[model samples]
Target chain A: MNKLDNQVIIDRLQAVLGDKVHVLGEPHGLLAIQTESAYILELLAFVKNDELLRLNYLTDITAVHYPLQEKQYAVVYHLHNLFQNIRVRVKVFIGGEQPTIPSATSVWQGANWMERETYDFFGIHFEGHPDLRRILNMDDLDVFPMRKEYPLEDPNRIDKKDFYFGR
Target chain B: MSNRITKITPNNPVFYDNDPQDELITLNLGPTHPATHGVFQNVLQIDGERIVSGVSTIGYIHRAFEKIAEHRPFYQITPLTDRLNYCSSPINNMGWHMTVEKLLDIEIPKRVQYMRVIVMELARIADHIICNGILGVDTGAFSGFLYVMQEREFIYEIFEEICGARLTTNIGRIGGFERDFNAIAFDKIREFLKRYPPVLSEFEELFVRNRIFIERTSGVAAVTPEQALDYSWSGPILRATGVDYDVRVTAPYCSYEEFEFDVPVGTNGDVYDRFMVRNEEMRQSMRIIQQALEKIEKEPKGVFHADVPEFYLPPKEQVYNNMEALIYHFKIVMGEWETPKSEVYHAVEGANGELGFYLIHDGGRTPYRLHFRRPSFINYQMFAPMSRGMLISDAIINMSSLNVIAGELDA
Candidate 1:
């Protein structure tokens, strides 16, 4: 009935999440909150089931590979409450040789393909993903092509040298 | 046994049904089947034509657009978006442009916004025509597909006149259109506007009341509003489930709020309702286009793009003559322009659904990361789950009605 402003939503989130969800400040007006990988599910569950702002729709689940950061991976979730017309972005930073985070498939069934696509591209494993394999690449793809190390152009191509193009 | 497809596998090495009397037959619908519109393989476990389960294998045509976008500059990414939902690429192009514009905080002219609305609504109509017509083809009705496809040519001609290409039309630039609508383009649009209605109504007449069509589609693959929401379904599919959530009305980008049109919804959430909802939305799209044409005439003419010289490519003649224009052109082409560190997610009510671009620009010439929340990719997840109890024919028609464009699906 009342419009759920960012303050009310953030207040509720802070109450339950405490310091886990650090307010990353509104980057482009969407409430982007950062949390550790351990608390992502708790943070996601609270916002989704909260009585006033039931952000029930899982818009998209994607991961960003940040090779330079202390945490090398950031798994992002965009959740929307269609009834209230509000959205909150939940991001969890995880890093290791095998970066894994608790899957959101428990919260949203639609997260299955999204998480699979994320894993396929970023190689960030979802701890409990029902089907965790490549969705958009060959089954035998050895490397995640989206990672920073993987160059777009073929390194072996002699014709594509920057010197040849007069750059 | 080692290669058992408990998860979706590319090839079937072995499949065994323990009970011989009621043994399930494994049927691969396609990585290349006519029923599966775009390239996708659905391995359906069926028993006497009743589907037990289906595992869909996508990614045959995955060009890795997201990977490609990360390496390219903002201006060059339009062609990649053009390929996403090639059926209505102008929307994808505009949506990508709008995302970049949001990052740069560029304000477009009211005239440009109205022009965009016309092109976008036209795309919506073209897309719905292809989809609903294909649904007819999927059903036994062959004549309706032929009749409706004729109208698509006029729309394609309108696009060709505007942007010199059709299908994968990179129709607009950042800030606004590359060029103002020429006289012939407007005339062709006017001609299309006048000609399309009767054909659309006739197409509907053949399918809407046909006892066979109704009986076939009415109760097939029905989903409730709650179920649809759970699957994050958007566009006509979710609308057919009786949810009035449309990104155009809800978020109102590109001055969409200024337009007067209704978001048509359906209650059944079945194959028939999805079909009817798209048909009604096409009518609404026509309404929006008519209003846009009237509204664009009232604005000051010839302002095709926004006034941001920093990003907007200047005319070739100016680049040759002027110093500022030449420097700016060089900076743009070389991807040397400055960008602030920020992340933005912008969604346009694409023909398929809420096609969103999640862009993360970390003070780089190119986006640090860009993720396309493609509607087909998200909505297609529900197909396998929904097809479990239905007959194989119903599953094929259900996939058709959902309008899963593989370009977007495996993007």
Candidate 2:
């Protein structure tokens, strides 16, 4: 296989995705790119099946909750092309209320549990996923715990109140 | 439906009509079956002894390490990492520190790098001993497990000499070790190296060619190369499927590229293959540690950590008389040092597989978001699918071979 770099990946993505793809810069030499949530599946498929840029290995799938931004969540995918020893970070921002994105289970079977874990913590619904449920958290949990709104401390802790602390 | 004798054949008669012949029994394999190494519940649909289907139930021990890491300061997060994949906590500890160092851009000394490789390799050997030893016990060979645990305790002694804990080490600081290796630590390592090989050889002699052990594990739960890769497997299990994708050799963190070691690959991804792969990997880890011991002697003696004063805290003795040391120590302890608003992903060849830390730091004392790409959690995803038509006994061996740590799975 030929050696593939950041520029080659960017150019290939631009040629296929046109205006849908955006380069988020290579932070720490890993090519990070962004695209709309709608085109994520197609873009992932293109890169995985592309002859030269076969980033077939999905290193990680996680989402970050950013409450201050216009788009409150950024679902990140770390994809690695094992042959060339290069990695790419794919990010797509989605709106806060009822956040949903297309699932990549059709592209990679490994996406099943990662998507479930992502849904378990951040509550980003993955459309077309085979199994989507709370993975690490109990099913009785009402709120997504990783969101900024939920405090880490328990609500029933009465002794640590401001009055008790002499505020 | 009465118990009347009816002739079905010339010499056989059927009497009772209460046979549940065509039913598939749903059995709970465990949240705590004595055979299960961890607290994972597999609800299996079995036809007699063979499993028709299975669904894994995890999160029995989930501590939300990621959620906790978001609030804790950088110096306080090492213990949180120690809980993940607890079989190799040093690897997890070093992996997290390397992630922070990648984000902060700290240059480590050669001595520190060699020291890390030695500790991490010893951790790998210890991890394999637990995994392979447990596999031996599951396969009805209990004597080998007892022999290996004795060596594993010596490794724990080495860790205890450096940092005062055995299991959840929390061994190193962010840039490097909290303190330099002592004379006793070096002696323990050298002694462990000399003492471990014979027991390892005995372990191999007991199981490698044994007929019963071979029959139980040779063809059980064999996955093809495509399936292993598609499932995002790493470490020995992936290597057992003939994929030489080791994060140590491929990505080469902690100066792993400098080591002369072999990435052992197996022909078929079966239980036996995984067992042999781990055994060979332990030997290779020993070789790497041996080389690291020799290499450390040539490097500078006193340099245990990097020269980065921002992250590495000053010595307590110097903090008393020297005002500069006092302020630096105070700043580091309180997490007051400046940091860049950078996001980076760093992976280490954990005892099991690629233990990655995806950190997004927003110039805060605590991480904005920290995600641990736990290898056991990902590698065990295909367990249910792979156990479809195997016997219940084979399933136990298969799970042991996978070495799915409960802590990492639920984290």
TM-score of each: 0.95, 0.96
Model 1 alpha-carbon drift over 4 Å, by segment: A158-167, B1-19
> lDDT by residue for model 2 over B189-253, one digit each (tens)?
99988999999999999999999999999988898999988999988999999999999999888
Minimum summed lDDT over a 10-residue window in model 2 chain A is located at: A1-10
Cα error of candidate 2 at position B84, Å: 0.5
lDDT string for model 1 (B260-325, tens) is: 899989988999999999999999998888888998899999989999888888999999999999
TM-score of chain A of each: 0.92, 0.92
Q: After superposition, how far is residue B287 of candidate 1 from its true place, in Å?
A: 0.7
Best model per TM-score: 2
Assess candidate 2 and give its TM-score to the true structure.
0.96
Whole-model Cα lDDT per candidate? 0.90, 0.92
* Residues A50-163, model 1: lDDT tens digits: 887799899999989888899998999998988877878888889999999999888888889999999998899999998999998999989999898999988798997789
Off by over 4 Å in 2: A159-167, B1-15
Q: For model 1, what TM-score is found for chain B?
A: 0.95
